[model samples]
Every structure is written in C-alpha cells, then in structure tokens.
Target: MPGGIEGFDRNVFINCPFDKGYEPILQAILFCLIYLGFSPRIATEANDSSTVRIDKIRTLIESSLYSIHDLSRCQAGKKGEHYRLNMPFELGFDYGCKQFFTDQRCDKKFLILEEKAYRYQAALSDIAGCDIKQHAADYQKAVRAVRNWLVSEADIVADGAAKILGAYADFQEWYYERQLAAGFSEDDIKDYPTSELLAAMKAWVALGKPI
Candidate 1:
C-alpha cells in the first residue's frame, strides 16, 4: 500500500504484536521474508500518529497477495491483562477480503501461526478447520514455519530454515558493524526500529547475503 501495488505478488502482510517480548520472532520473520526476495509489510513500517491505524492496515492487506498471521499473543499472560484482538482481527479482515473481493484478491493466501499446539482451538474455535503452525517461541521454528509456508503457497524455491538462520546471524553482524561505522552508537543499535531493520535486511540480501 505504501508503494502501491508494484510488488503485490511478492508482498506479505505480517500480523503480529509489536512488543519487546515478540521482537525476536518478529525479526526472524522479517529476515526470512527479505532473504527469500519477498517484501514484508507490517503496521510499524510507518509511524504516523495522525493516520487511522485500521485504515492503514487494511490498505496493506489489500496490497499483499500473501499474509502471515501470528495469534501467539492473543491470550492474556496475567490474570488482569486483557487479551489482544488486533492480530486475529486483521487476520479475519484479510480472509474476508480474499473471499469477498474475488476479482482482486481471490488468489491471496495466508499462514496462521501460534506459539503453542492447538491453543487457538480453545479461544478461536472458528478457525479449527484451518491448519495452524506453532513456533513455541523459537526463532528458528518461526523461520522454518514461514519458509515452508512461502514455499508451499507461493511456489518459491528457497534455502532451508537452518541455512537461512545462519545467514540471518551473519546479516546481524554485518549490519551492526555498518551501523557503528556510520556513527550509530551501541545504544542506538539496540533501539533499532523494525521498519529500519527491514530495510537493512533488504540491503544485506542485496549485497549477496554475505556470511
């Protein structure tokens, strides 16, 4: 949506929580998508407090041919915490878009991710018939799930998860050095934004995904 439909066929809408706890898996997903030559679209790519958030997200979903929905953080972790609905909410919108907009989005595909086995069945029983993949809070498993999904649904020939993980580690080191050389402090690196990190991953892949 940000760049129009130029890369719509290779664009992937990422629906997940934006929090410190989910950062690792989030990075893994971003790196995997960029490494495999796909564009990863997430709400954080822009920081416009003035813009209506759901409208921005719907624009992204409509522009993407594929999506990855993570329902891992839907359940509240503590007794007083309210469960999250944004992830599942966007996922439903994407599904409905594909089903209702037959002419424009009939071919859209999505992958559902959970952190635990059969967890969605208890809270989101309507999706019981859909196949969901669990990551168990492991970045490597997340990479594998994303890689396999892209391969199967998008017909992409890609590197295996382990190899991609190794390359991801290499990119982190490369990016850290580059940022420091450009005068970014260690603290700055630690606070790197996901939107910026996605750009760095694309640059790393462009440079041949050096290891």
Candidate 2:
C-alpha cells in the first residue's frame, strides 16, 4: 500500500473522519484547474513586421482626439444647462445687450442684460436634463455655443481680477452684513442671490482657495 489516501481501505475512506486539511487541498486543486482552463493564449503564427506596424497604426487611430470621444453622444454642462453634441449650434446673440450697446443712460439696459444672463443660465440648466442618447446632437450644439461665448464674450480681465485680486470683496461684505442684519443665520443664506454668491466665490478664489 502507498501509505497515503489510496492506502486506506475504500470502505474505511467512505466513513473516515473529516479532515479540515483536506478542504484546503481540494480547494487548491479546483483553483489550479480553473486557472489553467481559462489561461489566455496567442492565436496562430506570430505577426510579421508589416503586420506589427499595421497594428500600431490601428492603435494610433483608436487613440486620436477624433476617435476618442463618441461625438454622437458627447454632452457638455454649461451654466446650468446640458448640451448634446449632435444638436445644431445656435448662438444666443440676443443675450449680449450690454456688449452691443454702450449706452448706460437707459435704466432698463442693465436690467435687460442681467435678465439675459440669468435667462441664458436658466436655459443651460434646462439642457442639463437632456438625455444624452436622444439629445446628443443638441448637446453638441449647445457646447459649441457655450464655447463661442466663453471665447468671444467672456470678461476675461474683470473675471480674472475678481478671481485673483479680491476685487469682489465689497459685494461679499455687503451681502454678508445684509444677511446678518436680516437675522438670517450663516446657513440660511447658503443659496442666496446668485450675484452675491458668485461675488463671494470670486473673493474665495482670489484668496487662492480651491473652488
């Protein structure tokens, strides 16, 4: 007899005491079989030099910017709106009243400009809910529109100053003081006026704080 499991009588093994050590041995055998069964293998003959170059070229194409993002489903978030990549680009030209007219004498001019910006923001927020699959085109269009605005009309100087020079401190101080006077707790004005909140944001940014 081989002095191992086989050495034991067949009938005796059937009624043998349970060994916790046997469990680990059985588990290891199963693990080995499963790992070997699924081991990956290269198919067929090795690739020639030309085939290797072609494979590299295919990989480059797959990684290009034009191939990276699925433009058909590309979407961008702007202000509060979501835009689909497939949508037609439409510039909100009507929203730039402040830039179009230099006249500050008109009382309604500033109001209209403010309203326009707010409306644009609201419009963008509405887009944020657009389904990416169904409105992919629309999202792309909106993204382009937003990009144009950010590139052409953004008040880069004032915005940078507000963000880097604490120029918006007056707005925040006034807002904070007003909230205090109104008996509102700090938390109460958490979502206060957009202008006031953004002003504070600019001050924070100016202080080199992470947004």
Candidate 3:
C-alpha cells in the first residue's frame, strides 16, 4: 500500500479476508482497529502554535531516524522473524513521512534534509500574520540553548556525532535558501549560530518561533 492515509484504505481491500467466507466479518473489525492505530492526527494542538508545531515536526524526524536505526538492529539479529519485520516497518515509516509533504523527497542521505525543509515551510506559513523578525530571533535563541548544552558536555555526545552535526549544517543551508525564496532579506537570518542551529531550525519548523 502507499504510505499516505488514503492509501491505507486501498491496502485493507488488498488484505481482504472477505473471499474466505466466514472470516470476513472478523477481519473487517480487525482492519478498522488497525487503521485507527496507525493514523496520525490530521490537526494537532501545536498547529496553532508555531513553536509547538516545529517541536512536533522535529520529534517526528528524530523518531523516524530512531525507528530506522532500531529496524537496522532487528535486521542484524540472528532470528529470521526479526529480520523479516525490519524491512516492512522501516519502509512504512519512510513512506508515511515522505507522503506528509509534496515537495520533500524521502530517500536515504536526503530524508533529514527534506524533513527540515518541510518543517521550515510549515513554520513560516503558520506564523505569517505575526512578526517574522521576532519569530526568527526567538528561533535562533532556542537553537543557541540546545547548542550550549551540547557544547558544554561534548564528551557524552558519542561517536559519529559529526554526521548528525553535519546534517544540521546542511539544514541551515537549506533554511537559508528557503528564507531567500520566501523574500526574507539577507540581514534577517545572517547572525544565527550554525553548530547549535538544529534546535533553532526545529523550533522554527515545529514551534513556530517564540511569542
């Protein structure tokens, strides 16, 4: 089935137990439950608050990544069933997020970047009636808070953290492009810190810059 909510309906038809005669009734109930279980809320409380929206989006992206990592571990297990479930679960998460935005691509090496871009776009759209400069400043401040935490406790950040850090740098670059496209002047976004920038970007995307 395709990853979007609509595709889920078609998928159930394909999994139909109706042809089996007696089991169709039971299967129908089961499918209904399954559908409800997997569906994400169409509108969240954060939708009204840009900051909350940005936080939720970043949480989704990180959750997706963590899910992927867990699936990888499952695939590496000696048990065959564990490995079998890994592929389907991983693919489902990938498709769900990919289908969330029309402009974002969802392949490896690009999923994180795509998520960031969609988030930024979402943030800007939500806060359009508000003060954009103040929003941007609040966003930057939140980012610096996260950066300060990471920098002060660098040793515990773990290995290969560079790769994660590099992804943020890429996100910043994409954010710059997005802001430019939105007609935000050069002076607006120039002073934001890059290293601790992911939190800021996430704030912008999820929470919609502070009040």
Candidate 4:
C-alpha cells in the first residue's frame, strides 16, 4: 500500500457514486481539487480493462495522502433497491490505512461529505464522531466544502470558494465553446471522456484560467 513520495502528497483519492445524478458534484470536486493544486485520483481513472476495481481503489488510497469520501448516496433511493455499501466500505479502508500505517502514511488526511448534514449518523453511526460536511446536493456547497477542506488540511494558500466557483464557470464556458468550435454537438460534449476534460482543466489552469 506504500506509494512513491513524489505523488503521495498531491494525490487525492475521491470516493463517491458515479451515477449521472452525481455528475455535477463529481465535477465540482474535481474542479475544486485541481483549482487548489491537487491531483484528484479515483478508481474510474484506471482504464485497464483487466484491472480489478477494488485493487485499483486500494492502490489509489495507499498512494494518496489525502482522500475525500462522500457517503451521501449510501442509502437506497427507493424501496426494494439495496443501499450502496461501496462508499462506506472504501472510506473504512482508507481510514484503516491511516490508523494502521506508519510514517508519512500516518499523516494522511480525510474529508467526509454527505448530502444532508446529519443523515449519515442515523445509518452509519460508527463514524459518528467524525466531522462530516454537508452539501445537500448543492454543487456550490460541494465546491465550498472541498475548497475549505483543502485550504485547511493541505496548508496551502488559495483564493476563496467564490473565486474557484467563478473560475469553474469560466472553465465550463470556455470548454463548451471550444468543443462547439471543434465540431462537437451539445450532446457530444457531455459524452466526452473525463480525462479529456481534466486535461483541458489543467491546460486552462496553466493558461491562468482566463475568463
């Protein structure tokens, strides 16, 4: 579970549901992390068809010094549908790594997010003592939660959440226009891979995040 020190400090493992319902929050988290100068890592980033998902997740957790686990969607949305355990399970794994691992791994930091502020304690009481932030499905709140967390935990100076949100809007508008100019339809832009979008984010950040 040991990762190279080079990326260990900057990499952040993001644990959240990948359903379409959560896309905006996911993108917000990514944008916030990148905007604050962290490398966001998630299981889906592993594109090797043969790679086991859990294995990839473990590698990401072990390699990352920081992690964000959103347990907002852990409950079943409807009757007869099973609740999702993967989010909490991964959170547990990451927590165990921090508590049991040695040296720099002990310095690992975590940010737990839930859709509603107090809902997680009702179902996941074991982690009741942990400070969990609430977003209530608001992408702006998600951005603020992540921005504040990064500034506090990473000990890095950053513009406020409003600045990041404003830049996110700028990035989206620029990306949208650029994709349209590239001959992609509105629908096609939504279908673009996250890797491409993230690369563009990096490029945009490098270019000073022009409006």
Best by lDDT: 1
Instruction: For candidate 2, write residues 28-82 as lDDT tens digits.
Output: 2112211222111111113345666334333322221111011221234356555
Runs in model 1 with CA error above 4 Å? 1-4
Model 4 misplaced regions, further than 4 Å: 1-3
Q: Give the TM-score of candidate 4.
A: 0.95
User: lDDT per residue, candidate 1, 85-197, as tens digits?
Assistant: 99989999999988887564778999999999988877789999889999999989999999999999999899899999999899989999999999999999989987789
lDDT accuracy of residue 65 in candidate 1 = 94
Report the C-alpha lDDT of model 4 over 1-211, residue by residue, as the tens digit: 3545568999999999999999999998898888888999987764788988888888888889999999988888999998889999999999898999887888899999999877888678999888999999999999998888888998999999898899999999999999999999999999777787788889999998888
Stretches of candidate 2 above 4 Å error? Answer: 1-165, 194-211
Displacement of the residue 7 alpha carbon in candidate 2, Å = 99
Is 2 or 4 the stronger prediction by TM-score?
4
Question: Residue 116 in candidate 4 has what lDDT?
Answer: 88
For 27-51, candidate 3 gives per-residue lDDT tens digits of 2222222222221111121235546
**lDDT scores of the candidates, listed in order:** 0.90, 0.27, 0.31, 0.89
**Candidate ordering by TM-score (highest first):** 4, 1, 2, 3
TM-score of each: 0.95, 0.22, 0.21, 0.95
How much is the lDDT of residue 93 in candidate 2? 19
lDDT of 1 at 48: 91
Task: State the lDDT at 74 in candidate 4.
Answer: 82
TM-score of 3: 0.21
